[model samples]
Target: MSLKTALRVIAWLLLAGLIFVTLSPIDLRPVSPAPVQLERAAALALIGFVFALAYPRHIWLVALVVLGSTVLLELLQLLSPSRHGRLIDVAVKLTGGGIGIAAGWLLWRWRPQR
Candidate 1:
C-alpha cells in the first residue's frame, strides 16, 4: 500500500520477467519490435530503476544485485541448448542498469521530501 512497498513489488515483478525471458525457450520469449540487445538492456534498466526507487539508501547493493543477476542469468542460459550466453550482452545490460540507477537516483533526489 505504501510507495516503498509498491516499488518493491514492481522491482520483484520485473526481475521475475527477466528470469523468465532469459531462461525460457526462444519460442516462449516475448515478442518485441526492438532488437534483442535493446530489449535486454531496457528490461534490466527498468528493473534497476524500480529497485533504486525501492531502496534509495542501498544504491551500491542494488547495482551489485542487478549486475550479478544479469551475469548469473546469462550464464544460466548455457544450461539450455537453445540459448547461448555472451559477454557483450552482459555489458549492455550492466550499462543499462547503471544508467537506470543514475536516473532513478536523480528523480528520487528531486522528489519533495515529506
Candidate 2:
C-alpha cells in the first residue's frame, strides 16, 4: 500500500483505540494496579505520536481529534449510570496524546523529503 494509505489506516486504528480506551464500558473500570494503567497510557500516547508524525500537515486537526475523543468519552461517562468522569483520567489521556504528538514531531522533523 501507499504511504498515505498506510498512514490513514494507522490513524483510524489509533482513533479506534482511543475510543476503546475511553468509551467502552466493559473494561473502563480502573484496574487494581496503577502501573498497568500508566503503561497502557504510555502506549496510547506513543501510538498518537506515530499517527501525528505521519500526518504533520494536519497537526491541529490531529490534536482536536485526540482531545475531542477524550472529551466525548468523558461526556459519555457522565451520562452512564455506572460511570462518571474524572479529571485525572482526562489529564492522563491528554498527557498521552500530547506526548505522542511531540514525539512524532521530533522523530520526523529531520527526515529527508520523499
The lDDT per prediction is 0.89, 0.73
User: In model 2, where do residues sit more than 4 Å from their true spots?
Assistant: 27-36
For each of the candidates, the C-alpha root-mean-square deviation to the true structure, in angstroms, is: 1.0, 2.8
Per-residue lDDT over 32-81 for candidate 2, one digit per residue giving the tens place of the 0 to 100 score: 55585486467568667867877888888878877677767777878766
lDDT at position 15, candidate 2:
76
Give the 10-residue window scoring lowest on summed lDDT in candidate 2: 25-34
Model 1 RMSD to the real structure?
Answer: 1.0
Runs in model 1 deviating more than 4 A are: none
Q: Which numbered prediction scores highest in TM-score against the true structure? A: 1
**Pairs in clash, predicted candidate 1:** none
Model 2 reaches what TM-score against the true structure?
Answer: 0.78
User: In lDDT terms, how accurate is model 1?
Assistant: 0.89
